[model samples]
Target: SQTIHQWPATLVQPVGSPLSLECTVEGTSNPNLYWYRQAAGRGLQLLFYSVGIGQISSEVPQNLSASRPQDRQFILSSKKLLLSDSGFYLCAWSPLGGRQPQHFGDGTRLSIL
Candidate 1:
């Protein structure tokens, strides 16, 4: 089983500021890493996914970008933050074949100040 860990449980940033959120998976190799965001009552939106190092897939055209630095380490970053970007950010990991359930981290609650 893989355990995902996300940092900075909560964050408050001013508009136009930069943001970086990280997620790491332990106990797994070559896992699929994912970044997701959830609004107040909306469903989870997939932001990015990585199948291997240096390979990233974006689901939307926003001010955010994701990177897979290591095989089990994934990062989410933005050069400029926006008010609409405030939400609960999450990181998840699953097996490569898409047959297993994903394990999510505690998540980070981001608020635009």
Candidate 2:
């Protein structure tokens, strides 16, 4: 079975600090990976996605970026953190070239102080 792993489970970072979050998948290859951020009660916002290695697509213009350095690895990073960046970030994956359900990780709860 395929599983998604994301970490750190929670984080508290000061404003203007650099940020790095990683997500990895096991038992899958060439899966479509996605990064989403949810603020408060708002719905999940698509931040970035990759259909293959080194093929990242930004869903919106934001203060963050994502990279797929390997077939089953995804990383989200920011040069400087913002107060608005504090939220629940989730990493997910679905089968490539299909409308299948995505498997999500436990998520990372980030708080900017």
Candidate 3:
């Protein structure tokens, strides 16, 4: 089956604490990966994207950052957490050159206290 991996599925973090979220894609080769954040009543915000290994582009100037550590692995991290950073984090992948539609994994719900 096609699958995308993301964790932790839920996170409760104190303000100012560090944060790390990981995502990996399976059953696909060299997919274009994307990181997105969805807040209540808001549209999906594209945070980062990678078309190839180590080729990352940021779409927003938020406090979060993303990295492509491997061909199928992506990591989102922050040295300090903020209340505004809390949201549903989604990891999605699509075939390159916009040939196919994107698919998303179960998102990680993050809350800051």
- Top TM-score prediction, candidate number: 2
Error of 2 at 76 (Å): 0.5
lDDT of 1 by residue, 2-37 (tens): 578999899999999999999999998999889999
Q: Lowest summed-lDDT stretch of 10 residues in model 1?
A: 93-102
Please, what are the lDDT tens digits per residue for candidate 3 over residues 31-50?
99999999988899999999
**Alpha carbon lDDT at 83, candidate 3:** 97
> Clashes in each model (backbone N, CA, C under 3 Å)?
0, 0, 0
TM-score for each prediction?
0.97, 0.98, 0.95
Task: Give the residue spans of candidate 1 off by over 4 A.
Answer: none
For model 2, the run of ten residues with the poorest summed lDDT: 96-105
lDDT of 2 by residue, 14-101 (tens): 9999999999999989999999999889899999999999999999998899999999999999999999999999999999984999
Pairs clashing in candidate 1? none
Superposed on all Cα atoms, model 1 deviates from the true structure by an RMSD in Å of 0.8
Best by lDDT: 2
Q: For each candidate in the order shown, give its overall lDDT on alpha carbons.
A: 0.94, 0.96, 0.92
lDDT of 1 at 51: 89
Candidate 1 whole-model C-alpha lDDT, 0 to 1: 0.94
